[model samples]
Target: MKRSVLLLLGILLIVLGVVSIGALKREIRISTNVTVSKSEATSFRVLSSAEQISSWMEGITLQETLVEHPENVGSRYRLTQVDGSEWEATVLDLEDNRRIVMLLTDPRAEIHIEVELFPSPEGTRVQIDTITRGSTVFYRTLMPFAKRSILKSQMRINEHWKRLIETSIESLVGEWSGTDASGSEQLFEFHFDGTADWKVSSSAGEFQLKNLLYRRNTLSQPQQLDLTGFQKGPLAGMTLFGIVDLSRQDTLIYDAAAGKPDDASARPETFSESATVYIRIR
Candidate 1:
């Protein structure tokens, strides 16, 4: 009787293993969409550019081209994540200003991503579809529990891209002035060449305007101005990250506070704080 019981247990284990292996081999697909306030051509341009793609995907340090091509099809890239993980991606298909399909090769699994852009009255509607299959039995068993988180991450990526395409550099060029929470006078000058100047006056007297390199923060919510100081001044060699809201064509609301840098070597000594409503002075 004991021998029979042991044999049955072994058979049960083998059956469970087979079931797990089969489940792991199953493919799953997820789809999501986001709307951006830009023409389809503009949106497609941003999506295809490696630099812009890296900026839109938060925590991705950079993407280096392994193989480059003018047509974009067959182009391969190596993506480096913030955590130092790496992945290989290849452009499987490309339709100018319409669609892009990419294959991501990772150790755990292989994923295919398809992006489609449609023109809308508000701007461009971006649809993203991702499909993947688990490669290992352990990974397959975890897929059911992990699938939701994976879909959420894809949604977040789309949202980041949407925010970035909506607030291009062209929309930010000009002069704006406002008052801080402390009733201090604040002024900002954004140039077409991607440079900016900021000045603020408070009880401590007026601070000199510092030259800054400004770019759109693609990773942040509601979109914001990413300012990197250039010369030696109060904000020299520092980043003043701030949120920008266009209340109207003529009015802008800006808010920012101090924060620590992710890289210790790049940390700055001083920073500034402000929450002001700016009117276009230009």
Candidate 2:
């Protein structure tokens, strides 16, 4: 009886050892797919914007770009969490309106994320795959639970994106007129195809913004708006990083920092004294 008991104990020890080794060698992977009722171009514009991302990504307070890239292929950002933790993310690859691969790293683990977009009958199909690897055995042991948590987080983020996109698209399709701080008459025409035109008339000159692409995030209290394209006047290719307030009917409280400020951190926090009030005309 003693000999048989000793053999069973030895077998249990061996099995546990094998299990621990296997877990250590494995990396946690999570993949989720969602379809949103928006075009691929619009979806990419929103996804690539750090401003829109901070609104939909839960717990993220800020995302500051350390390096800027026109196509975002080599951009790097520092993401600050609500709890004050920080993570660094670098863009590994990008294809216009198609695919994006990014790597995020922290003290505990490294995460590789790849997002692929496809045009679907419903709208745009987004596939997100994340692979997380821990730096220590203790962290690795917790990865099984972490995988489930990450999956839930991704799903929730996608829902936020869907709601923001749908709400903004419905609310911002018309002509709006306002007066800027300089007393210039400003006219903005937003089209359903995700394009817009800005015409400003002033004593100095008349300026027109052409080939503009607008993306909005209505998830936050004061909605966020971004306008990117070339300008026909002195500003050239300045992008508008701004906010919109739609609490009152037929009114839009617009405040924006013209051109790319020093960084995303330079975006306006609230309606400044220079805020332009716009009334919907059409």
Candidate 3:
């Protein structure tokens, strides 16, 4: 009877081991592309260039720059994160204003980042292909979970890129200032109940535009918003909507699709029509 019991336990263990192995073998893949339309190649070219890489990729800020000069094919650069951890990457291929591929590594983790750029009806379509392969038994087991989490985070990251790209657009063509463009002298001062201010604006007449967004972090109660809208004409009913990242440096304005006019402020669903100063900052 003891021998039969031991044999039964051994079979169950083998079946569990088989199931675990099958689970680990399953793979998850995610891909995303964002296009900035009608943009000159210069914008994409400058971003991929070595000189301004850090401006867009904030993570590079935490690393120590161990290599300098143009990162051409076969060139390598080393960086160390804040915790004294390190990553070494080498440029594997480059085509001016078209594509770039690099292999990234730290002592424990490895990722390949490929950036491809092409013209689109709206602007330039930037395809970022990221394949992270882990070498150790632990990281290999963790890769699929990591990949799933990272893909969700990518959506938020794209929104960040949208804010930056919108900023770039405004830098190229000045903002559609309220008074001159829309004939409204609305003294819009969006002082959040906390500390942070950054937004995107596009001025195309008679079109709905999502002008501003703000977020705040507070311990006393739920965060809040304060806006002073000034307009008496057609845009008096226009509304503003946005998302605020408590941990981020900027807010994302949910403008309508790039080609279409922005959404008007009066949408009852997921929009607030009134603007009032809950607290005055003297």
Best by lDDT: 2
Q: Which stretches of candidate 3 lie over 4 Å from their true place?
A: 1-28, 38-40, 51-60, 69-71, 165-282
Compose the digit string of candidate 3's lDDT tens values, residues 120-227.
667667787777666666556566557667686666655565555544421111111223233432222332121223232334324322333333223312232222
- For candidate 1, write residues 111-209 as lDDT tens digits: 788999987778679999988777776666666666788888888888878777766532555567888778888888775346778888888888756
Q: Worst ten-residue run, lDDT, model 3?
A: 169-178
Ranking by lDDT: 2, 1, 3
TM-scores of the candidates are 0.52, 0.54, 0.47
Residue pairs in clash, model 3: 36-123, 36-124, 37-122, 37-123, 38-122, 38-123, 208-262, 209-262, 239-265
Model 3 gets an lDDT of 0.46
RMSD (Å) of each candidate, 1 decimal: 14.9, 10.8, 17.4
| lDDT for predicted candidate 1 compared with the true structure | 0.70
How much is the lDDT of residue 110 in candidate 3? Answer: 72
Per-candidate clash tally:
0, 0, 9
The TM-score of predicted model 1 comes to 0.52
